[model samples]
Target: MEILWLSEEDVKGSLSMEGTMEAVEEAFREAGRGTVQMPPKSYLIYKKYDGDLRTMPAYLEEMDATGVKVVNVHPENPGSGLPTVMALVILNSPKTGAPIAVMGGTFLTNMRTGAAGAVAAKYLAKKSSKTVGIVGAGAQGRSQLLGLAEAFDIEAVKVADVSLDRCRALEEESRTFLDATFEISTDIKEVCDADILVTTTPSRKPLVKDDWINEGTHINAIGADAAGKEELDPAILRRAKVVVDDVVQATHSGEVNVPLAEGLIALEDIYATIGEVVAGKVPGRTNEDEITVFDSTGLAIQDVATASRVYRTAVEKGLGIRLPFL
Candidate 1:
């Protein structure tokens, strides 16, 4: 048996934003229809290093796809010239449980996550949305912009970050891929006021306030993927129509976790999952004046769906190294 090994560059080179969005959307639909089996991610915390490792696994029954992702998050890695997050994925055959591919998942993680945000925005955000606001101008922020640009005709982008350098860098980079005007600021209020807001920070406390957001605004809450992390004011959650990626995962670790834990909101308050909305079981935005939020906790099904695409593309293009493993 041969196992294919794909590097980070190989995955990025093979995947496109548009393709990834479509694949992730399909994955959401499958999940909504209860056709996929994805367990909640298991975590291993290292208090000393202030980081955590997560193991995510999923099986798409209809697609006959199965995969596991091992990922880590260390906020202090950047000072040592490393990324804050890194990941690896192993794709396997469902019938025999044989490993078919081992690939770098860091880039895949960013792309799929971005694709999720884009998919949420497609379903939740208004069709006339033109201005986008991004908080935390990191790699994920750039990926969010890339994915959103593919879905919407964004005319302007407002980026907010603690570090002006990061904000400026994101602004400069946006010029290459996005045909939009970019504004860099440290003011969270300015960022939250856009037609569409994307929160990508690892902030434990809420950076956006309830009053900063206007009616009809759509938010993609992408940063808070672990317990105790939240980016939006719980007050915002109370009034907005919240759509989560996965109910189990989102309640435990997504943007809604904090609010749900504090009793600020109830499970019943969440309107629907993005999958439910995508599957047409629930409506997205009913009116122009309704505020909407998509709480994405990054699903394992997304990993497998995206990895499957990368694997097929690699085979067609003769990429990656095929090594005999058995």
Candidate 2:
């Protein structure tokens, strides 16, 4: 009859980028092994507010983790002095289907998302990756940098954004966790010069052109989580080896969603899933000369896997408040 309730700060305090990467990578491995159950994220759009809410539920059988997360995205929230994205997660006992814990999913979501990007790059990016380029110097961009720094020895970074303030802010913030030097610019093309590139913009149209990107670059397309959203030109996917988090989900709501809808690409064009690459079922970075693209839609399994860990660690360290209501 009692459930643990963790605040946003409590959740952040309980989690680490390193631990999250390990959990997310293992979660993908389980997905590759067919031991996880996850449904595509369901969304409810609020046209008036220019925002959308999503529900994601998943169970990782081998990890003994099951949870549902309710998250919202409102790009204009910053104008009102609030975050564009916020979320909450509820963990339940699989045996009895009882709520065991409730925690803030906003930070957890960001970290897990960053973790997913890093996990994808770990297998797909070249071993000699040293430079990183990123579009959209926002929270997700910063998290992506932090995540990449954990996975690779990045010596230099290039950042592109609409706001110089946000770009500078990311550089200052990154100083705490990342030790790389930075170059800030307003041109997306200028930022694409790197061994590894991460695009985090919520562009409905393509921002990165095919010719601007060179060969041997690994791209993490972090935006474009909806049906019509896209970041890279469809041609980039046509030429590069494309990997998605999930086939069904990515088709409807990932970077490839637009391309697939317009017939610019076909389902068979997808080379493999990230899970398959992590599980060693498929080869990664075959020659270091072919481009690689990781299309991430943010899986429910990732959320549950991270949330489950946070709950256990919080319980051991006495981090959250114990509630008697549920």
Candidate 3:
């Protein structure tokens, strides 16, 4: 059998933010409609290396797409001139169980995660959202801004990071990439006080305070994908209309995990899944004064949808090299 191999550049060049958001939205709809099978992510913690490996697999029956992603999160990689997150995706044929394509998933992962955040904001954030705040000035932060610009008419951006250099770098990049004015701040509170806020750090404790968040602010809690990691204070979640990507996963590892584990919030505190909101089964942002939060754990179905898009685009453009596999 012949399998196509796509590099990081190939995958990144093949997909666009608009197309990725559309595909990811469809994937969420499929998940809500019970047409997708995505098992919870399996993890192998490497405490010695201060990192972990995750295996995510999913099959979207309606879309006829199946894929698995093996990704790793190493917080210390940045100092060594490496990315904090890297991944590989294997696209397979469900019928014959044959590998159809193999591709780099790091870029795909960032794009899909950003797209999910954008979709959540589109459904939950106020229509007049003009200011965006980003807590972490990393690759995910850049991707989130890119996706949000595609979805909303963002006028200004506030960025906060532990490293002033990273914040400055992000400010420069945003000015060039996004049609918005950029401001760098050392105070996390300043970043949290915007029309829409995105937290993408690997922080173990709450970086955003309860009082810092204003009413009608929509927050995309993109960090805290593992146990013991949280960004926003539990008090914030207690009052906000919390939405999760998946109930099972979110409660165990997503932003809701810490709050639920602490007994500060219950399962009933969660209003609905992003998928349900996308499928139109649940209402989003009922009132302008309501505080909304979308807790994202980065589902496997997102990988499948995005990888499928890259695979199709690569094939159409003849981008990847094809090799025979036994």
Residue ranges of candidate 1 with Cα displaced over 4 Å: none
Please give the TM-score that candidate 3 achieves against the real structure.
Answer: 0.99
lDDT value for model 1:
0.93
Q: Which stretches of candidate 3 lie over 4 Å from their true place?
A: none
Model 3: per-residue lDDT, tens digit, 1-326? 79999999999889999999999999999988989999999999999999999999999998899989999999999999999999999999999989999999999999999999999999999999999999999999999999999999999999999888999998888777677888888889878879999999999999999999999999999998999899999999999999999999998899989889989999999999999999999999999999999999999999999999999999999899999998
lDDT leader: 3
Estimate the overall C-alpha local distance difference test score of candidate 2: 0.93
Compose the digit string of candidate 1's lDDT tens values, residues 1-326.
89999999889888999989988999999998989999899999999998999999999987789999999999999999999999999999999999999999999999999999999999889999999999999999999999999999999999999999999999888799888888889888888878899999889999999999999999999999999999999999999999999999999999999989999999999999888999999989999999999998899999999999999999999999999999
Off by over 4 Å in 2: none
Each prediction's TM-score versus the true structure: 0.99, 0.99, 0.99
- Write down the lDDT of every candidate, Cα atoms only: 0.93, 0.93, 0.94
In model 2, pairs of residues that clash are none
lDDT score at residue 122, model 3, on the 0-100 scale: 96
Provide the lowest-lDDT 10-residue window in model 1. 186-195
Across residues 1-326, which tens digit of lDDT does each residue of candidate 2 receive? Answer: 89999999999889999999989999999999889999889999998998899999999999988989999988899999998889999999999899999999999989999999998999999989999999999999988998999989999999999998999999999999888889999889998889999999888999999998999999999998888899999999999999999999999999999999999999999999999988889988899899999999999999999999899889889999988974
